[model samples]
Target: MIKLISKTALLSVFVAFSMMKSQSVKEILNQEGSFRKDTIFSIKSDSKETYLPVTIIKGKEKGSVFTIVAGIHGYEYPPIVAVQELLNEIRPENIKGSLIIIPIANVESFQKRTPFINPLDGKNLNTAFPGSSNGTPTDQIAHLITKEIIPNSTIFLDIHGGDASEDLLPFVCYYNRKDIPENTKKAHDLSLKSGIQYVVSYSYTLTPTEPAKYAFKEATQQGITALSIEAGKLGTVQKDNVDLIKTAVYNMLENSGNSVKRKSKMVNQKSIVLLNQQDYIRVPEDGIFYSELKSGDKVKKNQILGYITDKFGNKKHDIVSQTNGIILYKVGTPPVNKGETLFCIGYNE
Candidate 1:
């Protein structure tokens, strides 16, 4: 196939190749001072792109990198607002490390005030971590976060709160992976330093098909210190909750030796571990639910936490607690479907 090509044709081929390479490398963030960048991530199955708004604050002096993520559930507004405040309040020149903040992880859901799974893929972004490049929309976002963002961080914070349809007590969680002793201790320490009232040692009971795919879990699996903090309530952006979240970020930064004025002290906090399926109570059938219990309330085993009454006003099921623990979260809305989570309880072994 020895054919003579024109100089114009050769130039066109080179330009096309260069453009492809440039698109592949797509710069996420590159600056030494405070800046904001917006990116349209082309990771959706329906060929739609997700808007990832990022805030970067690079210190004048070189130090460790910390990444903070919020709005994984989209409808959780307090953590999202807290991240936005961080972008505005932090002085990059005064710090020693870089801070990368993603105020809204799921823009589509956030815009619509949707809860849980992505509308396009029907996948929970939290459970779709370590995702595939060719998978669903949520999966692709997870893959990008795991592959690109998490690897660049020495420590990562996955901040969250109750979605628009949920009500929950504030708590902070870190994965308890005994296999990695060094990172495990650091994660535990970070949890205590997070300025939250309750610290939960969370470990997944993985099956053959479902491994650990949560944001903090997958990040910690890669040897990065990670923690998850839950604050706010019922999809509302309360200032007190936002301030609590903001304190955690600054606390972690100070603990990690960032050039902050005050270091965070380890607060005396209650801790719990989730090791059984009974800890999570799910709706048994489709009905309108009425709950007498709220988050942080202590309940006894076999106690009736709430009752589900059908549309006709007949009680269909009695929501009961299977473990002697404190209520961690509950559905805020009365309408619920079968198998939907109604309440999460935290218990000690």
Candidate 2:
């Protein structure tokens, strides 16, 4: 009888242990650290390709949802590299909020390695906003971003570079409107922490075309803090700029309490701020432009900002500023057309 009782006790203890193990296993399986990757949109081609690859890193803890988008223009390669770097560095354990990264928004443009305007439709993906369901390929992609992506995001960062022939100064563009809400301000402040050199206050009236129709403006309208970052020259990937961008992104995530701090300083608070309220000096006739002032030089109103000369060195026009401000930019090449912008001056007001 004693032996039988001992045997029964051992059996009961074993069963209890097994039950406990099973419960623990189930709990582990249901835990939040399980990261998942999915394709939000599939390309509609004969090959049935997947463009605009998005990677979502859902954190174990509950926090804000941040969306980082790049490659809005196919030729802009630096932004793509920056996004990829951000993806590879982010870890699920360190993330408090969800991070959704769309590394290449214009997949068709990217694949072609040329800036595509969709000859059949004459559409630029950057300008197509709130895209249509049954519209062109670019339009549909834009729609997906507006409906599926932007709505859920609490903060957004749209990355880009200069176009194929231009080299843009590293800057962050934010709309400066009195109607901007508090949440948008918060996100904008965080964006300043990214340590870029310049910040352009965007206006709603600037982009009247398609892509601008549904851009950072839409995000701001939804009360999401959004900023557009310009990194390097378009079509070419610069390693230094990419590294800087990666550092800035990491800093933003860390500052937002989404990850751990690896760097003490992420932004240059003393960076130059250029206001876009100045008038542009237009060339009166077709001529070669010779600038008398540099981009950062200050000048007075009616000053000889530059001169336009003909092919035989005949002065045709005098480029003058309308207000006292700094010369922000000048024509890179010569032989400009009449009424073409020769210089831009930012006022001191």
Candidate 3:
């Protein structure tokens, strides 16, 4: 069943959307028929003040609340752009469930052109799950989603892509939370429904007692089915990648009976599941990295994946793959920092 948003919490949200009145959320959540509202939720702290752009849509019949969040890593443009485009494609009248869309979760980082972490508090918004109310800007934002949105949603998808310095292959991932078997099954089922062919999963490093670190992980911990969809590369918007997100999200929504009937059918792809955790090469020191291989390149055990050099172009280290696997992602730019990932490999064996 689709849960309703808290009436008290809805009033605290400041509405900045020109088309929506401030009372829309309260009115819709209290007794909803069919409504779609565009609004903004503000997060303020002593040092940071930013707002999230949100779109809430409900169908005539009540169903699951399917939430889609993009721009947790602000530099990733494709998913962000895809979500914005989705806003235009979907209408409330045709939907069967509620949709809580957060197009750009880190507006501050997006505006400042920051990558990986929030520019305001130097925090990775994805890592700050179940955040503190009095914490940093990113923390407050996470808290809002965890407290306000996650509780009201039945299914969630957090979309991401390669940051400015990284190139990544397209894949779909969900947390392997064995403690919650039923929820895990739902999440895994959603990953397979994603249009992406490469399906991967991450096991929880933390125990069931601990709150998860990632946004989708937190949703899983809270009993909501969630997934993380990755695409695009090197911070640039690729039309193919953008369309992939569009197709995957709409496909998932359509399957869950939350979206309008469409001619585009859901794809059943040949899923390549990486059986092991990602084997990564991290730099020992700041240097310039050179690699001819891109994401999806195959590598053999002990093969020279790349080389790192001192700033003056003298080789310092020859990066080698630890196992035979396919490269999932790599730092795309030249400048490398100590402990930064040079390459990430995934394997079935």
Candidate 4:
């Protein structure tokens, strides 16, 4: 009898261990109503030493498929926090379509607290889109996202921020294509309703080196709605901004059935300027930059925006505006250089 009892006890222990393992994995996966939550896939380093996680939540109802991607640059923390908060609040019972939230796209960079390039492959994941299956570490991840994730999405929201090196105003960027489709417009409008302070319609000619250029362009080609949201400063998480982003996501989900409301009127007037472009000005030479102007400050042509000086106490350059417009951005650091962008001036043509 003692031998029989021992065997039964061992069998019970085995069953308990199995149950615990099943529950642990199940916690990572969930399904409710029409919504299905799955990790989908993961990207690992060449040696398989590191892996980045990606999650997808599909709503059962036949509505729309929106993908929210954050942490493209690991140092940008606001988007990550915002996405996590969103995931916690969203319910499958209420959702009509699918929501794929990849809260941390670059886990390695994030873990190392780096910006832009993945430290492993020295490649910017954002730029290497529609990537090759046999490409480098970053490229393979990009390929996975573009080929496996993006194609299945009907709408895409790429969350971003300036970086640990700089501070940027919050804004939404959309391609200014004359033939933009209705779905694209819907996405843009919904983004604006998220209460972002600025909505900037940008053209391809404006940003020549944007890493997400291919992703945005591809979304446009597929007739899928895609927009980018720029939030708090890089590397740090701002609670207020995260709250704002979360609020925006909730607003988007709630308002998807209704027509997106545009709070700001479309202004033909330029309020922000990109340097080396249409009407923006560049620093003439290297020196100590002293700016009398702040962001949003209006300036006239030839107005002394700032001055640059050499280390030897010699005034090397005088930064001036080329047109009458508002200042969109200015250097926050002390040292300034020639040909380096000093300020952005927005002017009415």
Candidate 5:
């Protein structure tokens, strides 16, 4: 004969099941000291799959939960190298808060040497945020980040750099959303505290009714303070750029009360913002791009930033600057495609 189950016991069982289902991140946070470095398998489809290789460094004592992610675009190597080195360098005992690091967010793209889009699903992983579990490999990875990693984070940093075909200046970006002024201001302050010299502020491209397409923006939308760092150029792992990213992360840790020294020097502390997403000059046609202008070059209004030529060496069109500003980033390689950003300019305000 079996004893009858009580309602209290049944409720306890239900609660335990729910926690087990949703508490993967909580379990990680509960762990102490030097801890787990593992892969989260997201999904498999068409005999292909995606994974999130993560490193969780829980402190000896409790504090804020900080998340750092790199390689959203695989060919951008500096942040990936920097985060990888950081994982090895940071000791669990030397902290006051938890740190989560994702060295290479786009592993498949990295393995395939693809630049911006995920080869498996042809989606830009950065743009697939707050993702759908029912979507492609890229979407699934984004889903894992949004669902699993983000819920545990109090602050999020998304690191990026120029891909193999572009030139980009070292900078940090924070969303200045009008609707969420407090979160926006917090992000702005963190960007200022970040060691990187250039600070870029941008608002949502769309109206407040639509969701943000960027990782940091989406995280900010979810009430998590977020910032983005862009450094290095033309894909190769430049040591200076890697060091720059490392210093920025170190600075972030210090700013967040992690008992770490800030490896940062004070910046100019001016308001520098991207003119607009529409300010990016697109390639006039599918052709080879020729540009004397690298990132960080001062330019004049109507200046010929670059030109494009067809495969047979026929002239296409002159890529001209629309405003007097600095070149924030531009296509550095010869290959170019129609509708791709030839360059973007930012002004000091």
Candidate 6:
């Protein structure tokens, strides 16, 4: 009463079904395997095509997706180098999920050693987030990040260092939100996992321009855990400083999920949550600055932090602090202009 097909016929049918399923998986879902692919996200025009390199690494098994980005300012060489070296060190077989690393976010700025703004669009890439597709090059790149990268990521890690003229001690920042308690806790835990010296929390403050436009800000708002970590000083890259950032990143990757496993050697570090932006000490006039205080120095209210003198060394003005705090960052260069920021102080207690 039953019909049995020939072995050859049955084998052919099985092969056909297997091929169909493979094609469907390839077309519909993200491919599962361990491999490295270099992709270019392009913003096209009539004359040229500006492209940003995105490195994609997918592990054998599916888990959480973590994205690490650096080189937004170009001159922040420490994070850039650390991310670059990650390509060689990270083994896909040992990872449980995906890893996307954009070593140089601003190619134009990185090529020209420009600080802050992209030379092509004359825009700060950091501030131009959740960007416009039809806008400048920087904005387009930001758009790609918001649209293409952040959406696919479970964690958005923004790495930075002191620019060409900034000197700072190492620190980590996590967004704080009272309304979204879970997100706030995740972000805080991410910061603490980095094992950095200082940790700052950003809360909501009504202002003319909102902070919701930033890349990390938008990421956190969308229920993703985001962190911005910083180290190094000035534009020059030091091997030790680069290693410090690299270690912190490895720590994050190891603890994020089943990405990798290693011995836990993280030290217990103290953190301070910055409630407001009242600790900035800006220059009063154009002058040459001489400061005995550097980043990490503790100060009291009304204490003279530094002295600024005229070119001829005749007129001198003492730069004083308005609150008791620890110096977060100081100007690396001696020359300063009126209204320029000289130092930023963090809450002491």
lDDT for model 3: 0.82
Model 5 C-alpha lDDT per residue in residues 253-343, reported as the tens digit of each score = 8877874544455455455444333268887789988877789898998888878888888888888888888788888899988888888
For all predictions, the C-alpha RMSD in Å is: 7.6, 13.6, 6.2, 8.9, 7.9, 10.8
Question: Please, what are the lDDT tens digits per residue for candidate 3 over residues 310-336?
Answer: 978999999988899888899999999
Looking at model 5, which ten-residue stretch has the lowest summed lDDT?
12-21
Residue pairs clashing in model 1 are none
Candidates 1 and 4: which is better by TM-score? 1
Q: Which candidate is the best by lDDT?
A: 3
| Per-residue accuracy of model 2 over 1-349 as CA lDDT, tens digit each | 4555573354444333221122322232234763746343443322223344667777777777778898888788898888877777677777776777888888767767766354324578777886775566677667667766777677878888765644345666666545655664665666667776555665554333434464566676555778777776635889977876787677777777766536435543576575546567777888788764555577887777778888999887777778887655555555577885567565535
| Alpha-carbon local distance difference test for all models | 0.75, 0.66, 0.82, 0.63, 0.78, 0.76
**What TM value does model 5 have?**
0.86
lDDT of 6 by residue, 180-277 (tens): 78777877777777777687776644242444567777677666888888888899898977887887788788778846656344665455454334
Predicted candidate 4 versus true structure: per-residue lDDT over 166-253, tens digit per residue: 3456666666554655765786677666656566555543232333535655565555677778777736888977876776666666
> Judged by lDDT against the true structure, how good is candidate 4?
0.63
**TM-score of structure candidate 6:** 0.84
TM-score of each: 0.84, 0.73, 0.89, 0.73, 0.86, 0.84
Candidate 4 residue runs with Cα over 4 Å from true position: 1-33, 36-40, 44-50, 204-214, 258-301, 307-315, 323-331, 334-349
Q: TM-score winner among the candidates?
A: 3
lDDT of 5: 0.78
Worst 10-residue lDDT window, candidate 6: 19-28
Looking at model 4, residue 145 earns an lDDT score of: 68
lDDT of 2: 0.66
lDDT (Cα) of model 6: 0.76
Ranking by lDDT: 3, 5, 6, 1, 2, 4
Candidate 6 Cα misplacement greater than 4 A, ranges: 1-29, 45-49, 206-213, 267-278, 314-316
